[model samples]
Target chain A: MRIVVLTGGIGGARFLRGVRAYAAADGAAVTAVVNVGDDAIMHGLRICPDLDSVLYTLGGGADPERGWGRAGESWTVADELAAYGAEPQWFSLGDRDLATHLVRTTMLNAGYPLSAVAAALSRRWKPGVDLLPATDQRLETHVVVEDGDGQRAIHFQEWWVRHRAQLAARRFVFVGADQAEPAPGVCEALAAADVVLIAPSNPVVSIAPVLAVPGLREAVVAGPAPVVGVSPIIDGTPVRGMADKCLAAVGAQCSAAGVGALYGARSAGGLLDAWLVDEVDADAAVPGVAVHPVPLWMTDDDATEAMVRAALRAAQSR
Target chain B: MRIVVLTGGIGGARFLRGVRAYAAADGAAVTAVVNVGDDAIMHGLRICPDLDSVLYTLGGGADPERGWGRAGESWTVADELAAYGAEPQWFSLGDRDLATHLVRTTMLNAGYPLSAVAAALSRRWKPGVDLLPATDQRLETHVVVEDGDGQRAIHFQEWWVRHRAQLAARRFVFVGADQAEPAPGVCEALAAADVVLIAPSNPVVSIAPVLAVPGLREAVVAGPAPVVGVSPIIDGTPVRGMADKCLAAVGAQCSAAGVGALYGARSAGGLLDAWLVDEVDADAAVPGVAVHPVPLWMTDDDATEAMVRAALRAAQSR
Candidate 1:
């Protein structure tokens, strides 16, 4: 079986662990079309937060406790940067994490596209799944929020990390989505996939920005594969991260049914053919889409693999 | 009194400590025209090794034992970079040190000249002396060496750090020096100085590259101030660093008198009006320049201050 997973950072990375576990047992090929919307330049280093999370998590180097960055990471660089009084002090980049950014930035500046850089970096991580960025071009997710200074667009990192997503977000904007093309293998992966699974990542900011790429949404909707999504929300709340705030910004109810309906039936001008919600949301309903309730908490690899199996079953049924 | 010093990394930084101490007692203003020859980009970071050495040393952040970088610096970034198999692994940049480079590279990329960037960085260090780059433009000291690949020029850092300066070097090339102008305050500092002291730094790569800047050499040689040089070589050997290898590359003897004569006399269209050698080289002779022997080893701040006092005496005599 060939599987293509659309993913974001931390939560998606955890979900990928399950996917990898299931794929390993099933002898299935997996390709991850990772969202690059959270990528930003900090202290002159190009940092792809989502890509690094997946790389570190899958490569067995991620800080399991923190769910982001390298295990045993040091904050020497961040502290020193703060000492220098460089602006944007809110986002703390760990010393070990900064190395990945440095290498990525150097490669990107040397004319290599983001996809090639991700591939080069993966050589060290040996991330089991083929990880390709959603787009090689710039595609930052900007959050329009009402601050004391009025509504202003801020980078997704600043909005999420610095502000803790507390600011009343007006909407989310994918800055360069109109011009972005899918990374080298993205379209092909979608076309050749036996099934496509949407990770339990933030639907608004994470999956939305990936789909924002001009033709990316079209590729998945028109591709010859069954599309299934694992709901990031369970019991009207996000299992991890501030998906509630993101969903609220778009005026969507913070529930599995809301997200399911958001990524409506592909036959009805939407993306998903099936939606897998947590067992707690067994009563959730989405018009024109198959909704299945399954135990979705990714407590461990085995638990996550079970969720992946559930997602595969939904795809097969569809 | 207004004193101007031209210097490089490590040894020069230590020497500046003495200069600062002496200037404090004498209530004299000091300006440092630091060598940019040792500056290079590593992992896309603009690293000004000589400037940083002076900054960290004066700021009391330098590793006294290691003679470079932050005293309590960590190697997280270096280890991570190595794991990624990034190129130019020979020069290991400490985590704290990488922060300095990030700030500098960011500022430079934002269109700030190096002098301004150094000045901005100095706000934190408050390195007693006015620090200035020898030139604002690219002025890398490249060593011409013959290897299996035939005669080729490589960055001085690569030659020193990677090969350990073991390669047979033909000469040193001050790349981009011909078109390089003195950084913002360099020429002005020299013109208005009461005296100019050449710190006991590498004559071939350090002090030579400073002079290579267009009109900077002329300004120093023709300026009204008496120029006195402290010999990096003591007892026929460099007190520290690979000055001997550099001098050998330039076909000069590795001795106090040899260096003094290499600088020659201001009246003879060369540089120094006087030279200071170690007492061990009391017999050292420079035909057209006055040579004074004193303690050259910078054992401590007090010892360095004593040497600075001796250099001032030489300047007074001239």
Candidate 2:
């Protein structure tokens, strides 16, 4: 099976790890389309948070403590940047992590697109799964907020990192989305895949931006592949991240049912043939959607792989 | 007296350590105009070799063993970059050193000139000396080599770091020098100084590029201050670096008097009221140039301060 998986940050990367193990057992090839909405320029490096998280997590080199950056990372660069009055102290750039930025930045300046850059980067780690950004062009997520006079647009990082996603977001704008082209192989991979899985990541901030890129949503819908999404929300709470806070920005409920409705059926153009929610919310229904009940907590790779297998079965039934 | 010194990498930064001590004793303000010829875009970060050398050396954070980068530096980034199939590995980029590039590249991308970026970087270390680049504009030094087809231009770093400066050079070219404007405050500091000291740096590659920029050489020659140059070549050898090789590229001999004649008196339009040579080369003479014999080895602060005082006396005599 040729499987295409769309992922976000830590939760998404972790879920993909399980998927990788399960897919290898079943003799399947995997291509990961990563979200770059969380990409920010930190300490002068172009940091693609979600992509790096997925890369590091799968490469057996991610810091288990931070669940980001590289294992056995040092902080000399971070300390120096901090001493230099660098802003945005929240996101730390470790010594090992800097190597990624340096190479990526160099390649980018040398005229390689993000997809090609990711391909080059993946060659070193051999993360076992092919990785691709949602789009080659920049698709920065920006949040509109109410200032003293009126609404002002803030870069997603400023809203997410500096403010801790605390303010009421008037709108989420994916800057450059209008002009961004889906990365090479994305459409072909979607068309040829046996299944498409959206990892349990924040729908509003993470998955939304991936789908927001032009032609990507249509490709997933038009494909014969069984498209399924794992719910980030369990009962009325997110499994990880500030998804609840983000959903509030769109005036949506934090419930699993609400998120399922938000990402409705293929008939409704909302990107799901199946939606997997926690056992507690098994009764939740969406029109033209196959719902499944599972433990839904990725306590270990085995548990997460079980969830992946269950989602695959649900896709087969649909 | 307020002193303005011209410097290049390693040797220059090391010499400044002594000058700093001497200036502190006299409570004098010192400004250092650093050579940007060695600066290059490696892995996309603008690496200013000389500026960082000076910054780290004065900030008490420089790596003593390697004599560049920061103390307690990590090489994870370099290892990763290498794994990604990066080249020019001879020049290592440490994690802590990357912070400086991050700040520099960021500021440059944001439309700030390099001189302004240097100021911003200096603010972090407060290295006491008013450090500045020779020119804000790109004035890259290129080596013209006899390639398989014909002569082609290669960047100085590639020639120096990659080839180890072993290739026979047809000529040396300072690209963009004709168009480059001397950085703000460069001429002003030179014009008002009591004494101007040329550090024992690569005469052709380092000092030449600084002089190549328009109006700078003229400013030095016309300044009320007397300009004194220290020979990078002692006897027939370079104290550090491959200066003898670089001297050959410019058709100059690797001797104190040979370099002094190359930077001849005002009648010849080169900036040299006095030329300081090591005690071993004291007998060598250049027509119409005052000569000072001193222990030019900057083993520590006391030795460098004595050299600085000798240059002052030479300038005062002129």
Candidate 3:
């Protein structure tokens, strides 16, 4: 089966490890349509957080301690940048991490599309899955804030890193998204997919941006493949990241029921043909969508593979 | 006196070390308008070679062994970039060196002009000389090449680093130079100078690009201050760098006299009112430009200060 998965970062990358295992055993092809909303230019190099997480995890270089960044990483470059008084000092650039950024940024400047660049970068990792950027154009995710002064738009990183997403967000704006065309092969992959799985990623920041690009969501909905979404929220909270803060911006509750309702059924114009929530939320109701309850924690390759198998069955039914 | 010096890289930076010493002792306000033509976006970082040289040399952090890059540099980043199969691999970005590039490239992307970024960077170095990029615009130096593949333009790094300047050049194009205006305050420094000394830098690549910028050379030639150029050539060859190859591109010889004649005098529409050559080449003459002979080698601070004194005397005569 041609499996197409939409993913965010760390959690998504780890889940990909499970998917890769399954695909390797079955000779299946997996194409991951990664979110570029978290993509940023830090220290002069373009960093696609989700893409890197997935790459590093599958490539066996991910740090077990931090759960992100390259394993056995050194901080010589970060210390130097700090010594020079570079601000937003929280995010770190490992010596090995910089190599990936340098290559990505260089190729981006050389006019290669981000999708092509991701493919080129993947050659070294050989992650057993095709990685595709949602769009090649600049589609920055911005948070609209109502400060004491007034309303203004803050770049995603400013909200995430600088403020740690503390401010009450009024709305989220996917800047340049209106004009952004889907990356080459993204629409085709979605249209041709036998199964479409949305991994438990940030609904507002990750999956939303992937869906925001012009033709991507429509393609998934129109395809013969059934679209399935795994809930990022277990009972009523995210496993990682500031997804609750972003969900609150759109006036949505943090519960699995709330997210499932937000993405009802394809016939109802919401995202889900099937919604997979945690077993804890077995009693949850998502109108017009096929709702199933499963153990959602992806603690190991076995747990993740179980989740993947459940998602595959959900898609196969429709 | 507010002294202004025009400089290139390595040699220019070493000369600035002596100038800074003289300026500190005499309490002179020194401003260096450095050439940015050697600047390139390497591996996605904005690399100002001349500015870096000045910063490292005056900050006392320059590698004594390589005479460029930082002291106690590590190549972890370069090794990783190589592992990823990065191109144009001759120039290595050491871990320490990568920090400077990261900071500069990040700031540039944040919309700070190169001149302002240089000012911000120099705060850490406190290089004593006010280092200003010659132009805010990207005026990359490109050599026009004629080969079996026909005529093509390659980046200066490709020609210099990758090819090692082995290819014969028909002409050197300062791409975007005609559209580039000098960075603010460059003309003001030129006009306000008591004396302007052109450091013993590569005449074609460094000095020529500064002159190539619209109105900068004209402003220098017409300013009240008498401008003097110190020949980079000694004993019919460049003291360092591939100045001979670049000089030949502009149809000039490698001898002190050949380069001296190339700059002629202000009245004849070139760079100098006076030309400084080695004491051995004192007889090498140009018609209108005053010629002075001095020990041009900056083997130490004392030698550099002596060269500065000689330049002042020559300016005083004119």
Candidate 4:
């Protein structure tokens, strides 16, 4: 069986751990098309936060408590950069994490596309699932916001990490999405999959940017396979991260029903055939979309695996 | 009085520390025309060993025990790179040192020249002497050698750090020197200098590459100021590094007398007005150049300061 996933952020990475575990037992192959909107060139190093989050989590190098970056990470390089007073002090560039950037940046500078560089880095992490970037071209997520300075467009990282997303964002802009081509194998995987799962990542930024790649959303909605999106919201709050702020930016309510409405329904020319909400949000409804209430909290691998199973069942039933 | 010096490598860096110390007391200005020939792009970083050496040494951050890099350096980045199995593993890219590279590479990518980048770094380091690159252009020192892989010209870094200069070098090529211009302020510094001194660095790869720039040698040789050189060799042995191997490549004897002969006399259309040898090499001689024997070991700052004093005296006497 082939299962394709659209994923990004730490929560999505954690969810993939369960997907990978389920595949191990059922002998299913998994392909993850990760978001690249969060990628940026800082200090001449091409940094891929979403890609690294997945790689680290799946490769058993992720910090369990922090849910991001390498376990037992040191900040020697970061401290030195700080000492040198290098600008953009917000990004927590750990030493172990910086190694991945060094290698990736080196490879990209040597003429390889982002997909090729991701593949090369995956060789070291052995993330098991076939991992691909959403787009090889630069597709940055820029947040247009009115801060104390004035209304301006800032990179997603500056808004999310530096400013803590406090300033109300007017909207999110996928800078290069109009010209971006889906990375190789993204369309093929969607076409060949028995089911497509959107991991419980931030919808407005993580999953939206991945879908922003030209023709990517169309490929998912038009493909023959069933598409299911697992809600990141539970009890009117995000499982983690500032998904509420992102939802506010997009004029969406911070609730399971609201998120289900955002993805909409494939029958109504949207992305999902089935939407999996938390059991508590069982009554949540989206027009023309089949909504299933499942135990959505991924408290542990077993719990997450159970959630993945519920989504798969939802796909089959749809 | 303005003092201009042509220098490179670890020895030159140490020599500059003494020069800095001397200047602090004498209230004399010091301008260093540092060699860029030893510079190379490694793992996408513009690595300038000599420039960094001088910065770290004069900034009170150099490892006194090891004679290079940060005093309390950690190899976290390097170890992680090894874990990923990144190629060209010979360089010890310390975490603290890698910070410098990131800032430099970023600035350079943003179109700042090496000289500008160096000056910016010096602001943080407060390296007392005014530092200038030999040339703004990419003047790389490549070693043409016959190894097990057959005859080929490899980067100076690969030849020096990887092979330990054990490979018999046919010659050293200063690639880009012919097309290069001396960095801004280098010619001005040399032309206005009251005296010029050549630091006791590797003649083949270090000092030679600095002189390789068009019209730079003319600025020193034909300028009004007298030029004095200190011998890197004492009793037929180099103070540090593989200068003997480099000397052998260029077919110059590894002796104080031989080095003086290589620099020759300004009267005979060569560089040196006088040469300083260690007290032990009293009999060392070069026909056209006056050679003086003095204490030459840089055991500490005071000893190194004494050497600077001797060189200054020689410049005055000439």
> What value does the lDDT take at residue B169 in candidate 3?
79
Candidate 2 lDDT, B90-207, residue by residue in tens:
6778877888888888889899999999899888777889998999998888999876788888999989888888877877899898899889999989888888889988888888
Name the candidate, 1 or 3, with the larger DockQ value. Answer: 1
| Candidate 3 lDDT (Cα, 0 to 1) | 0.87
Query: What's the CA error at residue A285 for candidate 2, in Å?
Result: 3.2
Which of the numbered candidates is closest to the native, going by highest DockQ?
Answer: 1
DockQ of each: 0.95, 0.71, 0.64, 0.83
Task: Point out the worst 10-residue segment of candidate 4 chain A by lDDT.
Answer: A76-85
What's candidate 4's DockQ score?
Answer: 0.83
Q: Tens digit of lDDT per residue, candidate 1, span B190-300?
A: 989999999999999899999999999999998989999999999998999888999998889999999998899888888988999999999999988999999999999
lDDT score for residue A93 of model 2:
80
Per residue, candidate 4 scores C-alpha lDDT tens digits across A174-232 of: 99899999999999998999999999999999999999999899999889899999999
Candidate 4: segments with Cα more than 4 A from true spot: none
Q: Which candidate, 3 or 4, has the higher lDDT?
A: 4
List the lowest-lDDT window of 10 residues for candidate 3 chain B.
B262-271
RMSD of each: 0.9, 2.4, 4.0, 1.0
Task: For model 3, report the TM-score of its A chain.
Answer: 0.97
Lowest summed-lDDT stretch of 10 residues in model 3 chain A? A85-94
* Per-residue lDDT value at B52 in model 3: 93
